[model samples]
Target: MSSILSGTPIVYFECRQCKCVLQNPTPDVLDEWKKEHQGHTVTETRKYPLFDLGYNDLKKAGELAQIANELGAVIADIRFMPHTRNPEFSLKHLQEVLGDKYIHVGELGNANYKGTGGIQLANTEAGMRILHGLLANSAVIIICACWKRSECHRVYVAKEYEKRYNVDSTPITRTSARDLLSSVEEKNNPQLALW
Candidate 1:
């Protein structure tokens, strides 16, 4: 039997006859490999992207857009009350800034956001279904106002998505997002750094 393992930092290709290794194989590459290999089975090990971002981390909607663009993901605002003191993080502003890439999944949000009540599954199943539909096309980055994942309802939502979808989720921190953004900027504007 032959198989192609993907959806991780690295992708691996193994066959009963021989082993071929490729790093970060794109969709085109995977397609070409399949055509050439013929009869080989393909198994994707890569989990869908389930990111948790706090507005406190990246204050600007443009910054959030950059991160989402880089990940090729839709921004899922998982806050029951999407309004925030910061105008940039407000629901209206986010919808404007993100345009088509933004969505408010209030169903996944915690109804008792102010109190001690935990995740309400009543609407969660519906919300998860919505997210499931989205995941079929692109990755999703769940966002909230809380600075820490442990201190936010997004943690529970992330867990639910992982369990329901049978895929691992990555948490995007401020530092990590900044680093990726920096790399992207450098790639785009190499001449700017020369000065």
Candidate 2:
């Protein structure tokens, strides 16, 4: 039998006899552990939805908040430089709009965002740790500036997250945003649904 371990980093697995402790082990590592400890059971303790969205798609901070609220997720700003010409997207204003539900994980940001070198993580481990902490509580919606997921660095971030956490990221499309917004509107004004 495996003994439970607790700490700030959150232990994912522990073997008392072998003194093998895995902290935040990736899916592959967990699989290997299962094979090594044939009789031991490994169960996924928690699963939180992960999503990627572009602020351009939502256009307004309020809409972003609304979408996050609908999904019961925290907004993770993954922009290396979380500033924009658009006042609403600027870090301070976005934080103001999102309040406690917003967090800027700059470490996950692409340092070469402006260069042709492609996405480069600023601090992969640190960023992942922060995201892991958040995942323990609620779903996470990673946001970036680019409108297209294919052309955005957030895609790379989402990929990295999937690799580290073994979770698939759902790309929030424009249609989905519109539908969520429409739902919010209808909920706010029940009469709107009749039209």
Candidate 3:
């Protein structure tokens, strides 16, 4: 049918809150969030450390992260496709779980997961608040879309944080989750994805 042929690519949006992608988020809602807040700053994008992992499959998480960490990854994107199952886990929860163990990895940019989230965050005061909290805790977000680009970009958070607070940020890269779990004695297990 002509309708099917004319459809735009459906980019999934992972809720920074739930960790699950907001599938096909409506543009009206996206626009509303952007309009609610004004005078927000956007930043240049830097390449994030990425790995190829299928996000839809929760089953292989252990296997993927375990092996990847064993190999030399500090963070793992074990999933590429954001599914409903990923749940809406906020960046705050992640900070609690990872604590200091969560080494900075991934790109330094904004959340581009939904492909609309970045635009949304620019508008929503609530979104900005959450981002500020994550930055306060020194959260290093990692979102992999296709292994080459970040589905969820948040480098802006890092750089903006630096500029606002007059702090210097050291971003890290990650090939897999294995790098995070490995110790100094582990062979081939790279540490501090950054220099």
Candidate 4:
């Protein structure tokens, strides 16, 4: 993993209060990030798609995991009760495929799905502990489908991490599995090629 993102005093903050994600991530920078982390392990977090209703299905998550795996990224599904809305797959299925890389970091377990209520969950002690434990000292990439940077939950997660660790979590704004894979595909061949 490249230390450039972690080595700097400047941390990236994605403010979710206003509903956003990591400000604009330059194409060159994203390409550089991909190049810099050639062999380093990456984690692709699978959450219910923010705007896309199709990705709420667990199968899409598995598809994304396959792409991430091909690109050397481990699948980390942070949803605890992923079956509440998506029952096509079970937790066992995710664990079976993701293996040791699967983690259930349900930061929003107690919060409402409407993004209201418990807005301060990240500021609570338990929330801080969970966020810190999952993010501290580790480089994280937040993925979501919001075109508006300030409206991405991945950005929200990053902001929470920054609030606690005072460090930046890279945010990648892609709306679908294909788009996510394509973003990397634009930078590197075969690695992101899933067609």
Candidate 5:
């Protein structure tokens, strides 16, 4: 054998990718690293996480609202058009989930299906002030909407915060209520999947 064997070695006895003739890590070394990693763990915990309640269907609102409550989030309902005629727009379930923290702020007009008007409204100076106030009190602000995160005006609002406040304002998007619920459940039940 040469003094230096540098290449992707095919043998299991040798390191696979390193450009050296080093032997493969022994099982003892691997176990020691695993034990060290397990003992010295570092986890980041966020005080508050913004939740966007993006459910247009009233049938599922109650379920999503419960999940949001379990996750400890505030709900925001954005209605551009007057919801006087729409009983579903009352969002009673969401209000119950958020309690006094529920806030509804938007212009009175026809629903901006294209969402351009909503984006503009959220990007205005007044809009920035309201968002700033929300951020001041809470570490995260949850935007409850009837659409996905990328398509919702809440994303625009987050970006506006990033621009005006010069802060990291990336909002987490929950496309599926089931997904969020499952994730929260997993966090609570650590033994469910542990070997």
Candidate 6:
């Protein structure tokens, strides 16, 4: 094992096709790290993962569900396109697949069906109130119609959430599963998965 591992960045595991990173660091290690840090524990914790199924193949959904389960994620939003008028289809697809294993959200953020923007957060006071309610309710929102994370408006929205709501509305961009979990750990208020 040393011969193969020597002078290497200890890739505990990896996929043959996708370069998505993976690791098996134990829960005890996370607990110890938490003990060392003086960070505040997240009470109203949520994953708030933003995803785009358009670029992703259907085969990845199960893997996504399993990963969320492993990470103690409570929600897996399957938000739909608002402009198309058939928003329920999004929920139907996820329901046929992931089912009730995680919480589902529709009409995430302010996404227009044209496959752009975060859910168009309400601009008015009533809209802000609604946005706040959505944030308080959701864990992971995967209804974006685009590929690149930069194109998605949720990133900026999450930043604002960090400033205003004091909740982690940010999206976790990890090359692998381990990196994702670590990102969660390093947050101002890390989410403790309820799985």
In model 4, which regions exceed 4 Å deviation? 1-59, 67-80, 84-90, 108-110, 114-124, 136-153, 175-195
Tens-place lDDT digits, model 4, residues 1-195? 221112112223233333333333467765565465555553322221111112332245566454544334333333334554444334676566666545555653324435565333323466447555544333222333234555435455556556655444443323344555555455578654455
- Ranking the candidates on TM-score from highest down gives 2, 1, 5, 4, 6, 3
lDDT of each: 0.76, 0.82, 0.35, 0.42, 0.47, 0.41
Winner on lDDT (3 vs 5):
5
What TM-scores do the predictions have?
Answer: 0.76, 0.77, 0.31, 0.46, 0.51, 0.43
Candidate 3 off by > 4 Å: 1-124, 135-146, 149-152, 175-178, 184-195
Q: What is the lDDT of residue 131 in candidate 1?
A: 86
Better by TM-score, candidate 4 or 2: 2
lDDT of 5 by residue, 1-195 (tens): 122111121122222233223234468865554455553432322223333444552345455555545545445555554243434446564465556666665521124545555444533566556655654444334444445666666666566567665555434434345555555566679775463
Tell me the TM-score of model 4: 0.46
- Per-candidate RMSD, Å: 6.6, 9.4, 19.3, 12.3, 14.6, 14.5
Candidate 6 lDDT tens digits, 25-87: 357754564454435432213323322233232234554554454444434343343232333
Q: Ten consecutive residues with minimal summed lDDT in candidate 2?
A: 1-10
38-153 per-residue lDDT for model 1 (tens digits): 78654543335567788788868998998888778889898998887899999999999999999999998888876766656338878999988777677788898888878888
Worst 10 residues of 1 by lDDT: 1-10
lDDT of 5: 0.47
The candidate that wins on TM-score is: 2
Error of 3 at 52 (Å): 15
TM accuracy, model 6: 0.43
RMSD of 3: 19.3
Instruction: Output the worst ten-in-a-row residue range by lDDT, candidate 5.
Output: 1-10
Expressed as tens digits, the lDDT of each residue in 45-152 for candidate 3 is 222222233223223344334433333333322122323334432233334443443332322322344564352233334443444444333232333333223343
Candidate 4, overall lDDT?
0.42
Which consecutive 10 residues in model 6 have the weakest lDDT in total? 1-10
